[model samples]
Target: MSAYAEITYEVEDRIATVTLNRPEARNGYTIRMADELGDAMDRADRDEDVRVVILTGNGKDFSVGADLTQGGFDFDPETGPDAAWQEPAGRCSKRIFTMNKPVIAALRGAAVGGGVTITLSCDYRLASTDSRFGFVFVRRGIYPEGASAWFLPRLVGMGTALDWMISGRVFGAEEAKTAGLVHSVHEPEEVLGKARELAREIAATTSPVSVAVTRQLLYRMASAESPFPVHELDSRLIGGLGSSPDAVEGVVSFLQKRPPEFSMRVDTDQPAYLPWLNK
Candidate 1:
């Protein structure tokens, strides 16, 4: 496992846990941390030992978004002269969109600004009872970075997304779930446990090859309009994965009424672009 000032990683029972470690600062993302996280996700996706990835924060708050007081990067449009604000935006965008493995965010604290965007990127999201979520970009005199401008509206609908982002108001875990941001809420202590449990369930039942293909397809469909090209991509992916060793193992295991022993290795040589670049 690599060391990161803002995050930590561990693997157990085929589940890879990626924790936001900077609790004192509310797990805020620094530029370097963002890059490290992206690299970590890439590693997790490529490693056959890892079947699922859980994302969580160490302290009371999940993440408060970008570290503003730390200096170097300024999001304040009034104070900043030009488009320097887009630097952090671009970095975060890359991190959220490029993760290949299924990510489940275990939320125990406030998820604000870029934090909300991160949570939205995950395949599944679980929040603790004490958790709170919001987008504070408007209050900070900036727009939501890290795909919030696009993801939020799509996840919660245009009207709700606009209201939440523009108001910059804080919402509790229950409200977040109701608004379709979080899938479920659990006790503070059970937050990560529930996330892990869910991950294990997925790992136990889902076909590794199919899961990866589905994740890619869903991501591509989120922003793309041309169904023809998307279908072509899907066909190609399925065609290749259908003949994989894992695919055969999955079917054989089902026939034998036993758990599949998935080979974690997967091919990812497909073309990078096919719409939904913002996600």
Candidate 2:
């Protein structure tokens, strides 16, 4: 087990659980924490032992957003072509978006500001009944970063996105589910367990190559404005995996009435790019 003060990672049955460990601060993300998270995800992506990644927080909250007191609120626009204002959050956002394995967010408390942005990057989100969500950048007189400006509108509609981003209103779990921010809501105690179960199910059935390719295509379709070249990318992905061993196993298993044994291997050496980062 590799150790981290702000985050923890563990692998079992090809499922990797990456937990936000700053409970005393309600799991807020400091700049250091953001860096640690990116590193952890990178480790998971490179490790063949990890086929799925589950992200959750320790203690009572998922994340209260950036730690303002720890200078998480500090941002400057004049740092040059690559400004500091964009570096930290942008790096973290890219990490989540480009993660090859499926990433699930387990929310048990407030997910605000950057916290909400992190949740938005997840492939699926399961929130506890007591969880609350808010896009609080406007309240602090700052614009939403971490691709929330683009991601939120796509998840919900533009109107609802505007309402949340501009108004900075707090919404409960049901509202979040209604707005498509979360896939399901469970009891507070069940949040992590349910996330683990979902991860296990996905791990049991999904081929590593198929999951990575599908995740790449979905991210492209959602964040890319011009869909012109995406078709080519999709065709390339499908053509490459059409005759893979896992794909053959999947088909044969169905005909033979047996569970498929998928190979959890990714041939790609680099993580895919996230379009949201360009904006």
Per-prediction TM-score = 0.84, 0.88
What local lDDT does model 2 show for residue 265? 72
* Model 1 regions lying over 4 Å from their true place: 74-86, 234-242, 268-279
Candidate 1 residue-wise lDDT, 125-180, digit = tens: 89999988888878988777777777777677888898898899998988888988
Span of ten consecutive residues with least summed lDDT in model 1: 269-278
Largest TM-score belongs to which candidate? 2
Candidate 2 clash pair list: none
Tens digit of per-residue lDDT, candidate 2, span 81-144: 4343454566677788887799999989888888878767889999999998999888889878
